[model samples]
Target: MKREPSLRERKKLATRAALSRAAWSLMVERGLDAATPEAIAAEVNVSPRTFRNYFASREEAILYSLAQTGPGLLDALRARPVEEPPWDSLTQVLPAFAAAFADQRHIIGSLLRVVDEDPSMRAQHLVTYERIDRQLAELIAERIGAEVRRDLTPRLLAAAAAAVLQTSIEMWARGDRDLALPDLVREGLVEVRAGLPAGAAVRVSSPSPAG
Candidate 1:
């Protein structure tokens, strides 16, 4: 069984999460240049050195909440009954994961735009998901009776799962408010499980030629 976090450990995690949120909020409100370690630390009532102890860079600090997404879901996946289909288990576990994004829903669009505008942030974002992808691959391999490194299936499944989560989040963050994030995630999972066939032709409107 996994060990429960001590009160001290919980406090440290809370501090780290606070720092990450402060960094992101500063970046959104004042731009990246304004979200310095000193500023972020000040927002969290911590010293700059304490911030450094938690995160190595401003980018890492800003993206810290993202780094926790996979592990929690992986734990849920592991606890699922062994007889459940791997794909079904993957799909069913997403609503719980989607709920974690509720706190960010308001600022998610700004967060996406900020990340898109900065190359370093964009790179760090990819790196975060890549790490999740690798860990998820290992879990999927165990579920499917495949080797993590040697079997391509596990890696592919992991990538697809990650893509579903990423795409769902992006769409929910930037698209209509009518569709809830969990519902969006469930829809994406359904499409992915159906092999993402291009079932219907998409209609497009094109600009008229300049006179």
Candidate 2:
């Protein structure tokens, strides 16, 4: 029989989830500037201290909520059968990522709006993207059996991929009409493949940028 999640793990997960929910709700209701950690704690029925225990700051908490979309996408990609190529896995998983945004379009729209309105949020958004790019690079490195380094080749490819993914996400988020996010992701991948040096082997196991 499969063992259940440990009590500690479950509690940690619950606390983080509650904190994320509380932060997002406060952000939507009062805008990011007005949603202080104290206010978020009060909204979540937790003390400010407890809130800090779960998150470093109000901005960090909000960033966590935004970054939560990444892991879900990774999980979907991991779930693809081994027989599938990396590209196929990505194509299959990307729609699921886009579908998530479509599901929470309003919250996403609100977050994007708030970020645009606040310089601090804009900086935080850039940091979040850097963090995501690093994670994607790790995934790519693992797939290609290469180390992530300052070298031009790895860095350039990673940067280009990240740019594509980021642009795609922004387009989908800002569009008046709903976009098929997965399709955009696939198109981006195709572009990446086309632009690579001739005779370069495409590794499907690696993660590509969302822009």
Candidate 3:
């Protein structure tokens, strides 16, 4: 029932993927400043103009692989049995999603570190996640039989799921914990489903007035 990509489309996808990998490697090795459009295009045996045809900027090219997370998560969620509850469906997909990047954990950590250091890269990173969140909201709406625009539940659930994913990955990327990324994702999702019990808060004391 589904149509396959044409030869041209397949070639374009391949070229784009190659560009993404080249950009990621260059950025990791040289940082953003050195990984310019020309450098990235050179790594992929292409012209700077060709890179423009595929991606708008160096940051976009480098973050392209990371952006695939949205499509991967959505596809996995769609594969879940429709009869399952929305929460259960969401909870089940996260571990698989986390596991997909298990071997690339170092790459993810490196990319995130680079993104955090630069304002433009951070902006691109946020933009990538915001797009993912929008797609997720739509999918959640379908699962729960809610209108995307009229109902808040789908949007809220999408935001919560996205937060859990991002937080868990960031913690795992730090390599401070003994558990695997998928385990952290599973635990985080479970905690959210449990209504996120209150924890001790860090309070800041008021400053004394100057004499």
Candidate 4:
């Protein structure tokens, strides 16, 4: 049996979600520059202080809405059954992720547009990417039983994979080009794999280096 979220936890999640929704809605209606934290707090029926408790700034409130998707990706990776290859697990989960993106197409498209137009938001976007890349590297290290380093092979692959996903999502958000997002994601992964040096494989060892 699984435990559900406690009331406090649920309320906290709801408050954050409300803030995110309110921020995006306001940004879409008005421009991103016009969606002040005070305005968003009023829109969500929360005090400005409560809004600050949930988010550090208006930009964080908006970016949090999109960065919240990262946990879903981690959950998808966790849901894969034992004995599945890392690549195969990733491939299987890509469709579900794409579906989620499709569901939020309008909000995501608007967010991307805001990022393009605002320098602060663009910096925030880069920070989000760096966070995701670090998470991906950790996941890859766990899967491959390899030491992860800034310049190590597995870490580089993880960074490349994360980049591919980011690029694909950017392309998808650019316009409705009749191409499926999952197809684009798969193509991105294919390109990532193709770019890796030939015969790259994880090597397992029994002993740790002496301290």
Candidate 5:
């Protein structure tokens, strides 16, 4: 039901995306100052004022590029049949989410520390993730009902799922360069979904203690 953007709008969006991508790549390669707004705009063949119209600063452009990780999730969830279990839909839809990270996994992994070191970037990163969490909660509620918002289930699942994604990325970013993020996410979500069912058949095993 959503209207598509006109060609002019699409061109604007593409330019904005290019500027953000340029800013992100430059900052990652040479640190933030190397990616000044004028420099970023120049990278994309745009004027500084044009860049300013899209983003207030170079930092905002970089963050905007970083936040692209989350956009497809809502659409993925919506594509599932209504009768499908939320957990099943989420788990199935998540593999595509993993694919989105493929091109930038290394870049994002390396910049994890850079983001941590910069207070503004760190603050923006947290805000971006938190906003996505709220958006996911809303989607889950819509899939079921608004009443689920009053109950803790939808919100809790959204939070836990977000945690799984964060943990997988952190693990990947830390050093496991070859680790498959989708597998980690699937395993973690399986555990969460299993834990929710009453009298759930699945159980974890522990070693017996020596006497």
Candidate 6:
């Protein structure tokens, strides 16, 4: 029942996928500085300008590579039975996303290292999450219908779910210790569903402190 992409659309998707894969592969093997945008485009037989058209920067390309799984996660979550609890639907589908990351953890670990060392790249990573937040909000809206705008529940649920899953994946990618990332992600989702810890306090970072 789904429509297949036309030739042109399929070609565009192929080019985008190639660029994303090339960016991650080169950056993982050679580090960010060596995997310049020009180099990545060359890998795909495209010009630097063409590369720029696909991605604003190397960081965006890297994040886009990882985000390949994001759409699948949303799709799976959306397909869950409507009678399922909202958080339950997310918890059920999130492990698949986590598993996708596990298959590519090597490049992801390298990407995380680059992000840690570059403020601008890290900012781009945050920006990428904003897109994810919006997409997840849309899915939440579909599940909850009217309450999505009338109340803040769906928005809050999306935020909480994002916080848990992202935090778990980031920690796992650090490679500081032995851990199963999918298991950790599942655990995080469970905890978020139950609410924050006994004494937890969230601090919002900003350019200036409130007087």
- Regarding lDDT, does 3 or 6 come out ahead? 3
> 9-126, model 3: which lDDT tens digit per residue?
9999999999998888888888778889899899989999999999998888888887887988998899999888877988899888888778877877887788778998999999
lDDT (10s digit) by residue, model 2, range 10-71: 99888888887878777888777667888888877889999889887777788886677666
- Candidate 6 per-residue lDDT over residues 1-211, each given as its tens digit: 8798899999999999999889888877787887789999999999999999889888888778556666887888878999898888988888767887786667667777888899978998888876787678778887877465676887888888888778888888877546788788888887776665643666666778768
How far does residue 141 in candidate 3 sit from its true spot (Å)? 0.8
* Per-residue lDDT of model 4, residues 1-211, tens digit only: 6699999999999999999888878888989866888999999888999998988888888888668777778778877875787777777776668766776666678788889889988998888878877777787677767777653855776677677678778888776455777788887777666764443565677798889
Please say which candidate is ahead in TM-score: 1 or 4. Answer: 1
Model 4 ranges off by over 4 Å: 1-3, 149-151, 196-211
**Distance from true location, Cα of 186 in model 4, Å:** 1.0
Residue 205 displacement (Å), model 1: 23
TM-score of each predicted structure versus truth: 0.85, 0.76, 0.91, 0.82, 0.83, 0.86
C-alpha lDDT score of every prediction, in listed order = 0.88, 0.71, 0.88, 0.78, 0.80, 0.81
- Candidate 4 — which pairs collide? none
TM-score of 5: 0.83
For each candidate in turn, give its C-alpha RMSD to the true structure in angstroms: 5.4, 9.0, 3.5, 9.2, 5.3, 5.3
Which of the numbered candidates is closest to the native, going by highest TM-score? Answer: 3
Candidate order by TM-score, decreasing, is 3, 6, 1, 5, 4, 2
TM-score of model number 6: 0.86
Clashing pairs in 1: none
Judging by TM-score, tell me the better candidate of 4 and 6.
6
The 10-residue segment of model 6 with minimum total lDDT is 195-204
User: Residue by residue across 185-210, what tens digits does model 5's lDDT show?
Assistant: 78768877778464476787998998
